[model samples]
Target: MSASLICELCPKSCRIPEGEAGDCRVRVNVGGKLRATTYGRPSAVHVDPIEKKPLFHFLPGTGTFSIATAGCNLHCKFCQNWELSQRDGTEMEVRYQADPPKVVAGALQTGCRSIAYTYSDPVVFYEYTFDTARLAREKGLKNVLVTAGYITPGPLRRLCKVVDASNTDLKYFDDGAYRRYSDATLKPVLDALVIQKEEGVWLEVTNLVVPTLNDDMEMIRKMCRWMVKHLGPDTPLHFSRFFPMYKLQNLPPTPVETLLRAREEGLAAGLRYVYVGNLHGGAEENTRCPSCGKDAVRRVGFQVLEMGVRDGRCRSCGGKIAGRWGA
Candidate 1:
C-alpha cells in the first residue's frame, strides 16, 4: 500500500499515509492501497428476528443471520454499541473469519431468509459488506442493511444493488445536533435515505429519543414531516427509547411519555406506520391499519404474536399494507 492512498468511502475522506488507518480505524493503508482490516474478520454473529433490527416494514417476523466487524464512522455520544463500534483495527478479537461464500453458506445452514449487516456501522466496512451481500444474493438470501446511512453515494449505490431492505438511523433533524454530538452531518444521511428509497429498497427510519439532546418535540415533528414529504406517508418511522450509555450516560432513560408523544407526532405528520421500540408492553408497538385503524401486526417483544393480513390486505378494512408479506 502506498502512503497516498485516498479513502473516499465515507464523508471523512481520509488520505492515508503509509501504514496508517482511516478515521474509522478499520481501513488501513497496507503496502500502499487501502485495505479493509476487518475483511472476513467478524467480531459478532447472531440470529435475530428482523424486528430486532426495529424494521417493522421489512420482512417483519422473519429471522436473519446478523453479523458485524468492529468500526464506526460516527463518534456518537450516546452509542449503545460503542465498545465494538469504536475499537481500533487490532482491538477486535476475531472469533471467526468467514468470507462471502462462507457467510452465504452459514445463512443457508441456519435457514435464515435474510442476511443482516448490523451490530456496528456497516459504512466503515463497505468492502466486506459489499462482498457478502453479492454472495448472499447469488444464494437467494435476501440482504438487509441495519445502518446509520453515513456513506457516500458511489459506495452506497453499490451496496444497495444487492440490499433488499434497510433500517437507517435518522439520528436527528438538525445539522447542529449531528455536528455537536456525532461528528457528522445530517444531509448525507437524508441523501442516502432518498437514494435507497429511489433504488427500490424497503426503507425504515429510526430516531432514538434521547433525554435532552434529540427529544425536542419540534425537531421530532420536523423529522416526520420531512419523511412524509420525501419518502412518502406510507414509510414506517420508529421512535426508539434511548437508554443512558457511553459518553452520554449521565442522563436518565428516555421517558415512555416522550416515546408516545413522538409516535403521535409522526402519525400526525401523516406517516402511516409509526412504532415505539426498546420498550416492552407498549400498545404502540403493534401495527395498525391506516384505513380503519385495525391491529394488522400484533407483536409481543420481538415475536409476531398475531398477524391480521389477508393477501397482504388489512383484515378489517382491506387496505393494502406496505411491505413484503408471505413472499
Candidate 2:
C-alpha cells in the first residue's frame, strides 16, 4: 500500500491516503504524490478592470485577464464566490480546459496587461498559477493574485517571483474571528502579507466589513495601524462593504456609514490610500494625493475618470505614489 501523502501548500497540511483529496478538495494524493487536480482546468475566467481587483496602485487603468479554478484552502462563511471556491473541479459544472499556453494566448488576444489569479484563492491552484504566471511573464504580461493570503511561506516565496501585484484579503484582526468564521488562523495570513511585501510584490489589502462579525471599530483601527507599521502607510487599504452571502446570510449588508467609518479609521491610522469598495458612486473611490489633497486618480465603479499622476508621482505635489505605474 502506498503511504499517505501530506499536502503542505497551506497551513492545513492534510495527510491524505492514496486517491483521496486534502482539505482544499482539489489537491489529491495519487500514487503517493500530492497533485493539484484543478491544474490547467480553470472553472472561471473573465476580463476585469485592474481596479475591479481593487488594486488601485498597480497599473491603474489596464484590463486584467482573470482566472480561477475550483477549490479554496480556507472556508470563509462570507465567501462571495463560494459556488466556485468551495467545490472541487469535478464537482463544478463548468471547467474550461485551457492550459498555460492557451491562457497566455487568450490574455494576449484580450489585450490584458496582466493575468489575475482571482475569484478564489490562487494558492489552491498553486502549480497552475505558477506555470501560467511564468508563461505570462515571458509573454510580457504581468501577474496579479487576489487571495486570502493563507499560504505557507515557502510556497508563497516561490509565487512572489512571478506575481507583480496582489490584493490580499486581510479578513479580520482577531484570530478567534478567523477560527470561527473561516475555519483558519490569522497568523499565517499576516505572515504571508509581510512576506509578499518583503518580496516586493505590489500589495493591497481588502477588508470586508461583515456586520456583527469583523466590524468592530477598534479592531479596524488596530488592523490599519498594523498595516502602517509593518506593510508601510502607503499600502492601499480597501474597506469593502459586505452583503449577505453563503453561510452568513443571516447578517445584513454592511452599511455605507460603516464602510466610511472603517475608511476613516484607516486614514486616521496613517494609511495613505483608503478606499471604500462594493458600494458605488462615492468620493471614497477616488485616489487623492496624500501630500497635496488633490485627486490623483478619479474612478467611478472600475472606470478611470481621470489620471493626475505623472511618472509615478502626484502631479500637484510631486509626492511619490507607492505603486508600479509603468505600463
* Number of the top TM-score candidate: 2
Q: What range of 10 consecutive residues in model 2 has the weakest lDDT sum?
A: 318-327
* Cα error of candidate 2 at position 221, Å: 0.9
lDDT of 1 at 286: 93
Give the TM-scores of the predictions, in the order they appear. Answer: 0.97, 0.99
Report RMSD for candidate 2: 0.8
lDDT tens digits by residue: candidate 1, 77-121: 999999889996578666478898888888999989999999898
TM-score of predicted model 1? 0.97
All candidates' lDDT scores? 0.89, 0.94
Model 2, 1-327: lDDT tens per residue?
888988888998899999999999999998998899999999999999999998998898999999999999899999999999999999998999999999999999999999999998899999999999999999999999999999899999999999999999999999999999998999999999999999999999999999999999999999999999999999999999998999989999999999999999999999999999988889999999988998999999899899988889998899887789876
Query: Cα miss at 266, model 2 (Å)?
Result: 0.6
Clashing pairs for predicted structure model 1, backbone only: 1-30, 1-31, 1-32, 1-33, 2-32
lDDT for model 2: 0.94
